[model samples]
Target: MARSISDTGSVVRAVRVWPVAGQPAGLPDSLPEPIAAVAVPPAGPSWPEHRTRFAVEVVGDGASGWHAPVSEAVARLVVDTLADGVVGHDAAAPRKLAYRPRASRHHQGAHARQAVSAVELACWDLASRVSGRTVPELLGGTVRAHVPVYASALGLDPAHPEAVKVAAWISEQGFWGQKWPLTKELLRQGPVAVARVLGNLREAAGEGRFMVDGLRRCRLDEALGLLPVLADLRVAFAEELLEPGGVAWARVRAAGAGVPMAAGEHAVDEHEQTRLLTGGAVDVWQTDPGWSGGLARSLHTVEVAADLGMPTFPHGDRLWAALALAGACCRDKVPAVEWHLTLEPLRQRVFTDPGAVEAGMLPSGPGIGLAPTPVITSPLPVWTVGS
Candidate 1:
């Protein structure tokens, strides 16, 4: 007789969150100042100097699953409220395990939501390991063997003399495209300056292969003014141009802006994502699994986007999850994933495999492939909860 799904599934036995000290290998001693810092003050400590990092692990009867590079606060939030519900539950059913915490608190906020998402991701990783399958395969067999990725130039300053050189290097590296931030400071420099910088970047990155992130710092008029320049440059897309929850304004902008509009990285739940999709807010969806309630919710958003004739280009924070979704979905629906050029090298240092890109594509690896490296030397977990 063949075993059923339940027979093979593992129950969650314990959950642990560890705080690792010191920076991982491959991170530069100093990083370029972020473009957003010019317009908006940073909310927390700088990444280079921030010595502590968190990783979550879910231990089960069959195997252990892991997800790293979350905040200490988010890891603590998991142990405090969400871990009790997760303990002793079926690890294979991550969505079901996530429901109690999501439904119980009306105001779990982004940190709490991220905690739930981390646990949910761990559960899926555990389930995939127990079943001897990759997370993408477990989700539904992969549609593509490799996922294309674009270089997201987060820390690279467009005003720097080497900006064009960096853009050309990224192009030479075979990235699908390069995205540069459009901070309000840059916008205030007037459209002439904006056009010149973007024009030079486009020429360096290759025509039709450059994208812009407005960083949600621009006013309606500023964003509208940018549309013509973006369209004339034949930019790939403009992301988060207006303030959050300005879907109506985004829709209006999309109607007239020849460049495609993208958002939803800040949408915390399915309801918010649904509103964005239904309101015709954007031509492209850019949900992040790590921050947007995990892979299950992100996948659902991808499906909804597909049904509505929109494409999803998942945010790059959690590269493994983004790669999993891109691998599982039709190429047309999820054509590419974002690669944070500056941050990913540091992020990848925690993983054993690093999931390196070749020819601008990441090969589908096994089980979300987030096994932590020896660099995570913390002997004691900050928090642990078990059945």
Candidate 2:
């Protein structure tokens, strides 16, 4: 069955993009900057010192306003191309509208696709609000209310013992799964050391499943060499073993290694996403709605992978990014979303209770379900396009 959004009779009136910073309004108020810096693992993406995030707000002539955070590259496009492109366009079929940019842009890099992604999501969010429904409802409803999550983080320096603590904390925090980088360990101690660390992590994680993020630092031979250990510890997937679109994908897929390989955190548009998923290059698809050209295309990628029975685990570095996908992910199909325990406090700074993980499920609320703190909203600017 082909999917196309039918125009529902609403027109986009305006779009606004801005940078924001704030403290979490949810329970357990915002942490002090110094404390937050200490709280998050050193290698995580978002840091307290650099808590600022880009946001895209969309308004409709008939529908209420909606907004979501944009990362990588959305500001320029919002003020230039996308703002003009979306105004006066039909608002009902967001994914269809998203196709133009996906095809038109030649060298669409991180920022370009991020703006497009933000626009697509703004349309869907506004439409969902207009229809008095949730984003997931528009996407055909979800399989469950609460989404299962995996604790995702990075290990400290090679000599540091924080990997054990990070793994232990993730396990005790109730996440059903865990993913941590082997950057320093692998560089300092080599594959054998990483294998031992993983074994220790498996012990620390107890019943939780384990996943490894190579951060594009693991070589083909290194990752291949670790397969036996991966199997021994029952590791689920090895992410970003080498640069995306490299021969490594086919090699691993053909190696009969039995270890599922994952990538796509850097996919900028549909074409790259297609190349990654269409040929069975990777077994597990790891995309970021914020970076993969937006929520619309990200979901499309998820659908494509789902058809092939490949699980979709959208990156969880950005809390808002995860919130946007909650309604679309199914427990049986998608399985888990990534969450960084150390960054939760900083994540809360942008929105109250960004998305709560309880008993291993992420239950979403209505209409973006997040409110910006005053630090990020004061003197807010809203851009409008005329009829």
Candidate 3:
């Protein structure tokens, strides 16, 4: 049972990680203004059909949640790392707690970063609960009641004809914009094939803005070369055309990909962002609080972007990042947030009321206000932390 939310000292007592079914009970009729068929992309290495998250129920006292677009397991062994850093700490000190894992000498590789991010999200949830506020409200009340959202069609394999149809259908609906992923196969087909798809999507999009996620589908020069074609297609931005921290980013600006270029979704600190932006490699900054070392780091990244006049846009299809960025976007920290059509109602199911959107904007609430409900597709997989 969940303990009462208290203002006094509350410490994380136990942590639970569980897998929830990815498919929604039913597609929500509300979002995208006029509902249309948005194809769910077949599961890929980046996004699978299952949802896994961490929940921290205050042991001695407070609250918490999980994020990431992947379901890589949180090792039972790492509980020690998390315990040493967070188990007994006050829930209110989220930044301090979120950094504890990194502060420890044991941090290693991407898995460690993902582990820390999970705990950090819980900390923010705990902090919000203790303060009787939503994370956004605590960050400072939002700038807009609802942040503008773009439909993320990462689930669709863009090279397929289904993608074109789905793109046309959803574009007819009201959304701030639409983003499609570039698969390895599509990129292998080279610029000619790429142009055809973008052109078709642009026509299908009507007036809706179109964007592309390179997903590292092609070489930097090749990605840059497509700029003129993308410009004609009116693409809003091209994301991750090259590797996140690859040497090629420094040379990207000189190549002048006519359309806007975006990177940094995998970047965790201002230092990383600075090196990427310093060279003018790309025009936009993509930061995901969940992926970029959690809320504190994300805020710091936004401030860093402001210093460089770079627009902040958090990238991902997960709820933790979605809600976190949504709060920040409402506060005007980010111009817009990405809402993966794949996660859709399934992601919202994890929340307590999960709220609703009006005119492409999500309603604000307390503590991110999400709780895991039973997923009917399969038996729930649960992980106990600090056991």
Candidate 4:
């Protein structure tokens, strides 16, 4: 046996940490009882001793890419921070070695963005299988061929029956666009009581065109008094009204507000999404690729909002990594991609290779491009990397 190259780069090539358990593959495992937890760090006493929490089902294939509905202390802090910092590097350089601060010294929360988004999506499915090309042509190709999605309408009280079974599965699931998130007592019952609750959510989105987050909860006179009743209930945009550090956000963009004023989801990188595109407070940028620090910083905020023409909209769990980075971006600045239907069916039932996201596009399929449908009713125990 001849060993060279500095003793095979100083050995260190053994990984097999396991601790699997299952209960999340897709819709209806269970959860709906005033269920709302976000406890990140509390209960002092120097916490860390495997407090035990559970959830999983973020699978992928064509090589590797599965961060399953994480938790179990986010898969043991991503397999103990990738077995102590990315198992000896070069796992295809995982986003240039996990953003190098010495691989963020034992990493941080959200299991360090789900172990750097599951080893940077399995190092981009092993660099699209060594350049055979996929994963959006190694992240800089393809522009369309579908990829539009937008459902995200979690439960809220429209007389809660799970909000009429989540508005009848977002109007019989041919999803295209939808949004929720409006609690501040429903914007303080102003603007004609929020235009009679946007006319009962435009009759539960029958024709579909929803979207009205108001995540920050408004206040520029309550988003200019709910913008002329959400432009007479057309209501398709207005997310995060205002609250991401501002310089008046172009004075809430001249208080026109006929609609369209989305915001970056707690952004903290890409130079704050180029300062929310130089303070226009976003005409639409809703990012959150693991909170602006993954998917190459949400494709560098969709290439700086497609060179300031502004039109990016990603904020929703890894829908195939935001539809494989919005199908290689630049389609008039990324038309859409946001889906949390029934609050993420355990990350959309493990994707066993299949496709269907109607209205708002996303057709194509196969390898690193939509084709999974794993909805295992129950089966858990299979974490691996080493016993």
Candidate 5:
């Protein structure tokens, strides 16, 4: 008889949260500094210059698992409140151990969700290590050997004169596709200019090889105007073209424009996801496990979306979880995952090789495969709570 997860007797023993200092890493000189679609004043010192990210680790009887880079506040929340529920529970049953508000009275907001997500991921890692299985294996054995990924050019300005060259280079790098933000600045250049830039990029990257992100920076009218141009360029999809929850209107307009729409990275809970699905707002769903709850909830969302004939390309904010889902789920359901070009390297600084992408695919590894290295020189956890 096979041993079950409950048979392992690996209950959670400790949870630690800490800040990790960012370090400078080499990036391609040809690539320009990435910029935000909506420029806002800096809240504090920038990355690699200060301690900007946090990490979480869960310890079981004889195994440990870790995840990184959430906000310090989230880390503190876990240490102060959430860790208590996690400490004596079955580490292998992450869904049951994950934090949830006591009742409807307690507000369930982004911070709570993030806190839950971090703790839950650490639990999954701990569970995987205790069971001597990878997260995908624990979820259910992988359906594919590797998960395909797309290069997300979050900071690369699409309006640059060399944008065409950059697109060609990305395609040559073996990414399944590339996604660039359709910024307000680019849209201000007028429809003709937008068409020219997208046309050049499409020609450079080849047909069906690129996507665009509106980043919810566009007015509904502005997004509507771009639909025809996107369709004409044969762009793969237009992601978050308008503000979230404008579902019904977006669905009608998108259907009329003959362009596929995508959204849901900000839909962090079931209410939001249900609205998108019931409204038939998008052709593609892009849930982020880190924000939507954890691997378990996000995977459930993927299944529901697939049943409705919607495919998911999970947002890359939490690369490991997204990769795990993509690897384990049906290929037709989870076609690929986003790989943010500017953010991933910085995020992976604390890990050995957990989220490395090669030739547009993520290679399989044990557990969540994220363990902090000496590179994380933080002397001690900012906070810790144990059973």
Candidate 6:
């Protein structure tokens, strides 16, 4: 019965992984330094942007999976990896497959982790579909059915004076928290200008939980100088105030900023998550399963944070997975899921039956255990066309 149930768990019967082609032929021979070199190319109605598809389906048995999750085209690399890997594995035992052994033993880098996240998400979706329960119920049960959200904006137009437009839109959606990235260029404009930006953001968001994500920039002294103004503005929490590292982290922690600090997205492994937690460097432990290995690793990170009595606010992406785990395990400390306000919603929309992200919580259901939405748009092309 267990085997039968596991076998028929996922709605998807089988899947295939295919690499879709980008417009411009081969990517740069050598990746540019400061690897943010891979900027996004524009796509419009005429040119449909394509992502590598792991043509996933639930099959009778003997299925397979592979990698090369990176793409010069799209950033949602995890979707394909998980779709490919989790296709045949008992969606019931997804956590085991997530930590499955590899021959060469690649490190838990972004690609590998993204793969795990995709599979875990799919498994949860399958479980929810099979069981007819929301993912939150599968995990445990929600403390609150709808989670309050904070609008995240590391991708918003910096020069656009109407930057507040997005925040206001989020406010309109009933989100109370709103965050914007702090660029070095903006910071160099000095505290006055920074204050002006903050004032603008607050005016746009009203009495919401406004936040600043520094994106791991700034030195200790620089952060120290900025802390007072941030605290005075009654900012909720200063995220990634200093570049993550032992010395710099220690310096920022020692600065005694009246305001709380949030960090830990850079933690690439379970051990690093533990070190950061033990070091007392971060007030909010933000784990990204797409970077911190996979669901198991992320769960371990959350466990560590929970042990220390801190909240685990995942650093965006794979939010459904994070919220599912949060519901199952650490409820109290899971303050809010970092809703990447601009990007993730589009991915959800592409799904035929995307998971219900109402209020904030990803609804719990059955099978792999979250809402069943066909997140994949289409299968990636196997052969290059018109070349």
Largest lDDT belongs to which candidate?
Answer: 1
Q: 1-387, model 5: which lDDT tens digit per residue?
A: 987654675677778776676534444222333223312223233543235677787777777777777777677677776777677778766666644333223326787778778877777777777777777888888787688889887666787776777777678778889998886888887678889877888888875377998887777667777878888977778887777666535554545667777888888767888888767777888898888878888888888899899989999878877877787897788988988776666566666554567777886443444233314557887777774
- Regions more than 4 Å wrong, model 4: 1-91, 98-128, 131-149, 152-170, 174-177, 180-190, 193-197, 206-219, 224-238, 246-263, 266-286, 290-293, 296-320, 323-366, 369-387
Candidates in order, TM-scores: namely 0.89, 0.82, 0.79, 0.32, 0.88, 0.73
How many steric clashes between backbone atoms does each model show? 0, 7, 5, 23, 1, 36
Quantify all predictions' global Cα lDDT against the true fold.
Answer: 0.75, 0.63, 0.61, 0.56, 0.72, 0.56
lDDT comparison, 1 vs 4, better candidate: 1
Compose the digit string of candidate 4's lDDT tens values, residues 208-309: 777777767677777777777777777767777767557554566677757777887666455666777776666777676654556776887778777777
Tens-digit per-residue lDDT, 50-160, candidate 1: 456788888887577787777777777777777777777787776567555432454456876687778877777888788777888877887887888898886567866
Question: Which candidate number maximizes TM-score?
Answer: 1
Q: Can you give the lDDT of residue 217 in candidate 2?
A: 77
Instruction: Summarize candidate 3's per-residue lDDT along 1-387 as a digit string, tens digits.
Output: 664434344466666555443443444445442233444434432343243433333343534433322343543323546755566666666546744543357564555655666667666666665556667765656545556677787766676665677676665556678998877787777778888977787787888888988777668767766767777887888888778656775556556647788888776544666677675666788876655666776777777676787777777544445555556553445767777775555556655445444465554333443223223323443445563
lDDT by residue (93-196, candidate 6, tens digit) is 55566554333355466555554454455455555556556666655565545554566766564435766665566666666477777778877887777778
- Full candidate order by TM-score, most accurate first: 1, 5, 2, 3, 6, 4
Off by over 4 Å in 3: 1-9, 16-41, 44-72, 75-78, 98-104, 159-165, 269-271, 329-332, 346-358, 364-387
Q: What is the C-alpha RMSD of each candidate to the true structure, in Å?
A: 3.9, 5.1, 5.0, 18.3, 3.9, 8.0
Ten-residue stretch with the least lDDT total in model 3: 369-378
- Candidate 4: residue 34 Cα off by (Å): 35
Q: Model 6's lDDT to the true fold?
A: 0.56
lDDT of the structure predicted as candidate 2: 0.63
Better model by TM-score, 1 or 3? 1
Q: How accurate is candidate 3 locally (lDDT)?
A: 0.61
